[model samples]
Target: MKILVGIDTGVNTGFAVAVDEGKGGDLIQVISLTITQAMARVIELCELYSKSQVYLYIEDPRKRTWFTGGREKAQGVGSVKRDAQIWENWCKENKIKYTLVHPKDNCTKYKSDTFKKVTGWMGRTNEHARDAAMLVHRRSVRA
Candidate 1:
């Protein structure tokens, strides 16, 4: 079994957990929560699946050079980048393997219907969760 986790770190963080059992069996779970809550969930899941091959992927906000949005957007971007850094540090400290993925690499932004169609995830989800889910969706697709 392979456990794949994807995170969109920001003020409203997103967490997606995908479990892949060989032979074309898989499960996906996604949710939007506060940054702290999301991190706790990630840690819990990692611990629970300690024996399995777990891979964590977080959106790297540090790749952005500039932002056009005003103060609010800039503040949000700053928060995201900071959170991403913290997540990276946490992964290193815990010796958990992880990957910092660029936002452009996963195509996070998707409409509700399109997201459901693309990922075959029917659960209710917010923008952040959708983005996070998309990060791991690629892994499931490949599997």
Candidate 2:
């Protein structure tokens, strides 16, 4: 059994875990968390599925394109990178086999529809989870 975990990190981080049960089988679980709760939630998920071979894929922080606001706004909005850094460090410390996935090479660049047809996921809500699942799908090149 192989377990692949995908994460779309940001202020509202998204995660998707895909379990391969052989012969085109996929069991996916999804979650969304605030920046503060992100690390703990991921750790909890890891523990629950610890028995299987696991790989964690997290979306790298995107560079801010337009910070039109003043210094205060810039400082406040910079939480995205800061959170990614925190999670990256935390993941490394935990000794989980992890990969930092860039948005350009994966679903973030194209759109959520990239994996909709292929994955066993339903509905259009919670794209964070959807992107996470897609990351798992493209783990080979992106990871």
Candidate 3:
């Protein structure tokens, strides 16, 4: 089994988990969670999927430049960057393999309908989840 976890870190972080079994198609789960909850969920998933080959991919907010944005936007960017760092440190501590993907590496903003059509996934999802899922879009193996 191969488990891929994608995270879009911020106040309302997006967390997505896709599990692939050689015999069957991928099973994907997407949810919007608080930053703290995202961390806890990641840890829990690591424990539950201990036997699987798990990889984490986080959207790196540091890659973008925030210029002249309002205070709120600036704060949000700072918080997201901070959360990404936390994720990186946790992965390093646990010896988990992880990758930091640039925000613009792919099309992160996808409407729900478009996301469903693209991934061939009928599950419900929010913008954050869509962004996170797009990070591992290549690995999604649908039936």
Candidate whose lDDT is highest: 1
Better of 2 and 3 by lDDT: 3
For candidate 1, lDDT tens digit of each residue in 83-143? Answer: 9999999888878778899877888789899998888888899999988887777574242
What is the full ranking by TM-score, best candidate first?
Answer: 1, 3, 2
**Best-to-worst lDDT order:** 1, 3, 2
lDDT (Cα atoms) of all candidates against the true structure: 0.81, 0.64, 0.79
Expressed as tens digits, the lDDT of each residue in 40-136 for candidate 3 is 8777877888823678889998988745669987888888899999989988887877889888785789999999888877888899988888776
Better of 2 and 3 by TM-score: 3
Query: How many clashes in each candidate?
Result: 0, 0, 0
Q: Which stretches of candidate 1 lie over 4 Å from their true place?
A: 22-27, 140-143
lDDT of 2: 0.64
* Tens digits of per-residue lDDT for model 2, 89-125: 8777887777776666575543545555566456553
Residue pairs with colliding backbones in model 2 are none
Poorly placed runs, candidate 3 (over 4 Å): 21-27, 66-68, 140-143
**Where does candidate 2 stray beyond 4 Å?**
21-27, 62-77, 109-115, 138-143
